[model samples]
Target: MSIKSKPTLQDVARMAGVSSMTVSRALTKPDIVSEQTRQKIDHAVRELGYVPNLAASQLVTRRSGIVGALITTITNPILATTIETLQQGLARAGFHMLIGETRFSQEEEGKLLRAFLGRQLDGLILAYGYHSPETLELLQAAEIPVIELWDLPEGEVPRQPVGQVVGFSNWAAGASAGRHLVACGYRKPAFFGYDDERENLRFQGFRRAVLDGLGVEPQRYKTSAIPSIEDGVDMIERLARGELDCDAAFFTNDMQAIGALFACQRLGIAVPQTLGICGFGDLPIARVAAPSLTSVRIPAEKVANSTVELLCQRIKGEEPWAANIDVGSELVARESTALRR
Candidate 1:
């Protein structure tokens, strides 16, 4: 039951009938070794299951071979999917991910940023909006490639920069959502959201579209400081109590929509009959829910891929276009808001 020992460079060198230095050169600097010798070293390494020590190699290269990811929360499904995609894509490019969650707190984000700065991270990926000026300054001074996702800043991109960013326009996506809801015949639609700045942008877009396109002013919608399943349930309960009134509702994210759906079921409110529900982020659970959720697909994987690509380019001293880039979102309709028969 003892664990087997890891095969070392000496084992491969012995099997290949070559010096350890020669085997190392064949594995790392293949150009310095003959093709025949390289092939022999490769075969020996494969037979012995000898893997290169990345940490040791990184010491000489002065690169950590690791990427730091700062996220608002770990429990968010959409963010989880995006991070998963990013990790997979980064791994393919010979990089590992070091994750830190801030729970959507600026103070926590600053602390995490400082901690990661001490590490040997080659790059940084932020999942939420940049709000901390100190953290931004540190990132700029570090000169490492930094990519921001999910949320984009409202004002002009700062001149003192870190690296490239790949994200979608949250305001535009919200406006699109508003248009879709209005086109689908929702007049008295309400927005259910969190107090985050990005969510505020979406709310503003929704308001603008409803006022301009629909020519109707939406009533005050139910919102919470923290958008979670429990908050969703509380909002629905209040609605049942006649505190809120709406024929259709737009949730900040799919998690809240799922919560609202469950609450509707518990209250015996016929979905898309007595009320309609829509959410942002086309999470997997959205499809599995009863009367599948109608939501906006955020292109999480594509954003992750593009972010890593841009970061790599920046790391290589390649000048990319703009620091900020926006990808578009798509509206996916499902039974939650299906047309009435």
Candidate 2:
């Protein structure tokens, strides 16, 4: 049997009766080429089954048409929504996304940054605003638009960002959750969360709210466990067994809150009646839990949209009017924190 060779740009140009340069422009910068010429080039490309050499095209236009995104994990419901929306938005703009998991590790993030930079990504989206010194250096020298999502930089409005930021205040969200718990008459609240910068900000805000509302300090439990239902179950079991002391508890995310709810059911502890519960990142499950959980709802979709908009603008050599976008968060009062008896 004879072997068939893959079609090339020259084949398309020949079939379309146009120069190779014209075909190249039609493929990469269709707007610049006339509509009639573009149609001929498109038909010829289809007929010849010619796939443009992306690497060769990148050399000419200095654009990879690829964007790199780094997130803590792909499993978090809140971050999952953000990633999905971001991918869809980038697709609409003729770009593709390359996702990486940092697992909240600055070192892993720095390593991924080096690898992504080697690929010459046109832009980068980071879920966390904080970065290691080496990662920051890489970003500064990369000369590409970098947009931070999920958490805003701490500063004044219109504050200068590394490049751009599209997220809400983690501190404000935690404070909102704390205030809601207090409003529901939960005194001596307990916090079950991580001891990282973002979660620490939340804890600080929560502490401030608890102090101001009830004049009592919230008991803090630092956990290095992956935010999961089992961990939440263990924490709630401890509360039930008198191992921890608090009338109310706040978790870092909804999965843990749901877990706590499960434990409460098994241990015969009525939610909101005996112990109030609140969580951040109001996942869909929080709304339908046995006793619906009250939680801070981060604007994942809004952040994703804003990140794509600003990134696309920067990639096109346009300055976004707003470099810092604070979508803000809402604390939804649900059954879990309705009232204290």
Candidate 3:
């Protein structure tokens, strides 16, 4: 027996003894079609191995069914989890995610935003804090729902006439870290943070909390470049050789803290005995490290889910309240920062 030609809607209609339009209605809008007709169309589709072209169907529905996402980088573990969760949430809502990485450049973000707009995306999600004037113009022209994640930029309004924003307070996250250190009885503390503005916000919060909450002004050690394990180790070594005095240090992130933990071990400095250490963003490595890192837990998955939900509501033309979601971070005291009570 010879294999038959690939089945089309016409073929399914002929097999099901219905008009092509009736078959289309049965497949696309089953509720509009009688149950018997819908079952017959489904059976015919199964028998013929007919797969409807989603793109063609979307054209008829006037829904591009795609969401454009822009972020600084994808390699970071915490960001990777956020994107994964966002994609999964969007997929459940019958939407696809188109991701673009800006590498932390405003110019690059502007270009990427233009490209996404060219694709006529259903919605937009931006991760970076800065936005170019050109990018803002494009966003205004596109007139689609845009969700800014992670940290909100200083000047931008929470919700635009055409778009929406969802984010948490970066400053609050840092303040939590400072309070944690102060509560743990670290008076002469120091801060190690990256150069990013978001990190700077955290640093400011940490500084404020130390002065206001702890009644002591903490010293700061700003990293010239991005915070990394090597930087953490180097900072510890430099501090050891200097006259600068600090009983504890709060690294900008857990990765850096873990590095400091190793450096302290090499120098024979007992953690929480002679010196204490803490970090932010309780990544997986934080928990599994030698000392089992004590850091702030930022809900990466929750942020993604909340952003997507906000975007969905915006897409449906429903005016959602300004989503200043402060999925607050909690300080998890582990062996690294815990003092024997």
Candidate 4:
């Protein structure tokens, strides 16, 4: 047969001697179709050089083959890495990523959720903290699967989860980090954290695990916005100048903890001897920051792998997934929080 315009599914069906519905099933749900017919359709597609229109298919299937993702910020290395791995995971399953930034804003997150809903996405991945009521409504009304990236404290929220959760507890990670510093012989420790909800939860864990139970109080400093190394440097300088009181400090993240290391160097103080420091996230910077900072190693890779697998499983309509799938974290001892310190 001579073809003029771009070949369509109709051409493939006619050439293969099958109906359009059979062609559709062969392409989408091949398991139910017979092998001989599937091979015939495959050969006809190759012979006719047919390119299926994904947009047209989506119009009928109501699935864009796109997964919506909302993250706090791309600048932060942790979330950046998470998004990267998430995309790779989705791509393996023939899905593309449609990403948005919330900048830790509930309103912006709600807008993104609504926009994604409008786009007819196949599913959603939220690496964010808070959600608006409108966003919740969108999720409840959505037929696709929804996953919250952060681990919600089992019973603290006083509400059921919006969807499946595939993450670890920030509080538990923070508490373990605090305990690491204390067990290393550091007393009068301080904590540096941001004003974000997740960071605040970590702070609570640190306080309960290190302060109340250990009989040591931290010189606390909580600031708004994303924490940076400068925040760590600035806080340590104040502590060095006797304006703050703490021989050691625990940071909500590695960026701040690494900052404290730089500040200690500037203040002519020795690490592990004069000051003990611990950070969360166990980011790569933690490993090369001179003394190699101690940190809570969040299983980000495992989290990514599991998140993708779990989301795909649900997308395939798999049932009986646990309410919360915890990919827990671990504490690493390093020179920064040496036992001799």
User: Among these predicted structures, which one has the highest TM-score?
Assistant: 2
Worst 10 residues of 4 by lDDT: 151-160
Give the per-residue lDDT of model 3 (tens digit) for 203-227. 8788888998778778888764444
Q: State which candidate has the highest lDDT.
A: 2
Q: Rank the candidates by TM-score, best first.
A: 2, 1, 4, 3
Tens digits of per-residue lDDT, candidate 4, 1-341, equal 99789888999999999999999878755667898999999999999998777788888876778899988777777777788899888876767899998877888898888888888888899886467788787788887888888666443663356778888887888788778777777777777887766777777788877765478666678744665778888888888788887777888778888888998988888998988888878899899889999988887777777788888788888873566788888998888989962
All candidates' lDDT scores? 0.80, 0.86, 0.79, 0.81
How much is the lDDT of residue 174 in candidate 4? 75
Winner of 1 and 3 under lDDT: 1
Candidate 1 lDDT score relative to the true structure:
0.80
Residue 171 lDDT in candidate 4: 82
Error of 4 at 270 (Å): 1.5
TM-score of 3: 0.80
Q: Write the per-residue lDDT of candidate 2 for residues 167-243, one digit (tens) a residue.
A: 88877888888888888887778888988777878888888888899998899987654588887899988887789
lDDT comparison, 1 vs 2, better candidate:
2
Report residue 331 deviation for candidate 2 (angstroms).
0.4
Where does model 2 exceed 4 Å of error? 8-50, 155-161
Pairs with steric clashes in candidate 2: none
Candidate 3 wrong stretches, greater than 4 Å = 1-55, 152-163, 213-216, 224-227, 243-245
